[model samples]
Target: MGRWGPDARGRLEAAALELYTERGYEQTTVAEIAGRAGLTERTFFRHFADKREVLFGGSTRLQDLVVGAVERAPDTPAPLEAVVRGLEEAGAFFQQNVGRLRRRQAVIDANAELQARELSKFAALASALRGALLRRGVADPAAGLTAEAGIVVFKTAFERWLGETGQRDWSSLLRESLDDLKAVVAGDEAQADPP
Candidate 1:
C-alpha cells in the first residue's frame, strides 16, 4: 500500500484487532499494527490517538446514532419507549456490524482497561440519551431512569446476542430484553423467567 492509502483507519483497526487477538492487547504495539497494515505509525496516530482507540474509535459515532434516533423519534411514545426506539436504531447498526462487534467484545473481555473503557462508553451513551430525553420534555428523574434502563436493556441484549450461535438478530434480542425488563418491573412473576 501507498503511504497515503485509502481506508488507512480501517486497515489499522483490522490489523490491531488481529494482532491483539494473536499477541494480546498489551503486547501489541502501534508500530506493529501500522506495519501489519502496511502503513506508518504517523498514519495510525492521524487516525487514532493510541492503540486503544482502534477498539473505541467508533464510540462517538454510536452515541450520535443513538442520541439522534431519540431526538428524531415521534413525541407520542413514553420516555422508556422513546429510549427503546433509540436502542432499536442502535440494534440495526450493530446487526450490520455484528462480526466486528463480536471481535471487539472479545478483545474488551480479555482486558481490564478495555473493560473499564467499555463501561465508560456505556455511561456516556446513557448520559447522551438522558440529555435527549430532557430535550424532549421528559422530567429529571424519569429521564435519568429511562436512560439507565435503556442501557441495561441494551447491554443485556447485546451480551445475549454475542453469546448466541443461532440466527437471532440484535433487534429481536433487544425486544426480548425490554420485555423481560418490563415484566420484572411490573412484578409479573410468571412472565419474568430466569436467564
Candidate 2:
C-alpha cells in the first residue's frame, strides 16, 4: 500500500478494472491493462495472475486485514461488534479506492462468470472470517452467524457507497448497515414472540 512501485499494484488494479469495464473482462488482456496504466505486462502479472484476479484483486489482503482486526479487537466485544470492527479495519483499504471498486462491481454485476467468482470469493471470505472468530474463542452459532452478518454488512455498505457520486466514508456506512441488520433481527424476533 505504501509506495509499492512507480507502477504499483494499486495503479494496475485501477487500470485493469477500468479496461475490464470498457473492453469487457474476457477481452481485456494483461498486456493491454499494463499498457493502459503505462506499466509493463510483467508488472501486471506480478500484481494479478489474470484478468479475473483483477476483479477480486484486494480480497485476499482484505481478508487478512479483517482477521487482524478481529484479533486486535477487545476481548469482550459482542459478536456483531467484532464483525464490524474487523470490517472497519479492512475499510481503510477502500477508503480512498471506491472508484476502482465501483468499476469492478459494475463489471461483476453485468457478467455472470464474474458474479459467480464474486460469490465464491465471498464464501471464502466468510469461511476465513468464521475461522478468525473461532481462533479468538468466539462461540459456535454466534461465530458463524456473525460472519454471515458481516458479509451482509460489507455488501450493503459497498452498494450504498457506490450510490453516491461525491466522496464519502466506507466505515460509517459499514457500521450503519450492521446496525440496521441488528434492527432487522430484533424486529424479526419480536414478530416471532407471542403477544
Candidate 3:
C-alpha cells in the first residue's frame, strides 16, 4: 500500500485494458478491473473517473503536449510543420505504450460508444491544435485546415503503426504520413495545372 500507491494507476490501466480486451468493453466493469489489478474499487476511482476514463485518461496529457509543442515551435515554421511537431510530441505517448495502444484501439473499434468517444477526442484535439496555430500567428481557415489535416496524418500514422509489429517508430510513421499528404496535394496541383 505504501510504495505500490505510486504504481497503482498504471496497474489499473493495464488490468483494465486486459479485461476490456478479454471481456469486451461494455461487459467489463470497474469492480472486475480493480479485482484484476489487485486493487480496490476506491483505488480505481482514485485513478480514473470511471471505466471509460481508463482508455481516454491520457488524452489530457496528450493535448497538453501538443499545445505546448505548438507554442514552442518556431514562428517561421510552416503551419503544417508546426502541427506536425505538436502531433509528434503527442504521439510519444503511443510509442511508449504500443501494446496498450493496440489493445485500446481494438476495444474502441469493437464498440460504438468507444468509437464515438475516440472521434470526440480527435475532434477536440483538432480544435485545440487550431487554436494553438492561431495563437502562433496563423490565419483562420488555414489554421483550421492545417489542424484538421494534422488529425488525419496523426490518425493514419497511428493506425499504421498499430497494425504492424515492425521496428518502425511512431515519429517515422507520422513523418511518412505527412510526406504522403504533401505528395498527394502536390499531385493534385500538378493535375490541375494546364499542361
Candidate 4:
C-alpha cells in the first residue's frame, strides 16, 4: 500500500490512457496502471473507484462547476442561453486540460464499453441541466427542450473543440452550435407553417 501522491490521480489517468492505447482497455488492468505509475493497486483504487471511472474522472466535478455557473448567472438570459453560457464559462477548465481530455476521449472512442459509459455520463449531465433549468422557473417541455438543446450544443461544441488545438476556445464553438441549432429549428418551423 502506497500513498496516493498529489499527482497520483492524474498520473493514474494518464497511465491508464497510455495502457489503453498500447494494449486496449480490456487488456489493461488496474495493477498494470498502478505499476506503470509507480503506485500500488490500493493507491489506484483510492484515486479512481474503478477502471471505467478513469475515463470518466472529474466529469461529476465538471458538471457541478458548470451548473454552479448557470445558477450564478443573472436571471435575464433565457433558459437555453443560461445553460449555454454556463457551459461556455467552463471553457477555462477545458482549455486548461484539453490535451489530457482529448487523449482520454480517444481511449474511450476506441472502446465500446467506455463509449457507453460516456453516453451515460452525457445523459446524466443533461438531466442535471434540465433540473437546473426547472429550478429557474422554466416549465414543462421548455425546460426539457432547453436542457436537451444545451446538451446537443455542448456535444457539437465539444467535437469542434477537440478537432482543433487551443487555437479555438470552447465558448466560440458553443456559440456557433447554438446559432446552428437556432437556424435549423427556425427553418423547420418555417417549413411547418405552410409557407
Writing each residue's lDDT as its tens digit, candidate 1 over 29-79 gives 999999999999999999998998899977888889889999999999999
For each candidate in the order shown, give its overall lDDT on alpha carbons: 0.89, 0.81, 0.87, 0.86
For 1-195, candidate 4 gives per-residue lDDT tens digits of 235458988888888988988888899899999999888899888778898898887788889988888778888998989999899877888888888788888888888888888889989988888888888888979988888889899999998999996687788899999999999988853456555
User: Candidate 3 — worst ten consecutive residues by lDDT sum?
Assistant: 186-195
Please give the TM-score that candidate 1 achieves against the real structure: 0.92
Candidate 3's displacement at residue 29, Å, is 1.1
Which segments of model 1 are wrong by more than 4 Å?
Answer: 1-3, 190-195
Candidate 2: lDDT over CA atoms?
A: 0.81
Indicate the worst ten consecutive residues by lDDT in candidate 1: 186-195
The residue ranges of model 3 lying beyond 4 angstroms of the native Cα positions read 2-4, 187-195
Q: Which candidate leads in lDDT?
A: 1
Residue-wise C-alpha lDDT for candidate 2, range 1-195, written one tens digit per residue? 323566477688878878887878878888888887778887677777777887786788888888788877888988778878888886667766767777777888988998899889889989988988898898889889889988999889878888976566777888778878878978853456566
Residue 147 miss distance in model 3 (angstroms) = 0.7
Judging by TM-score, tell me the better candidate of 1 and 4: 1
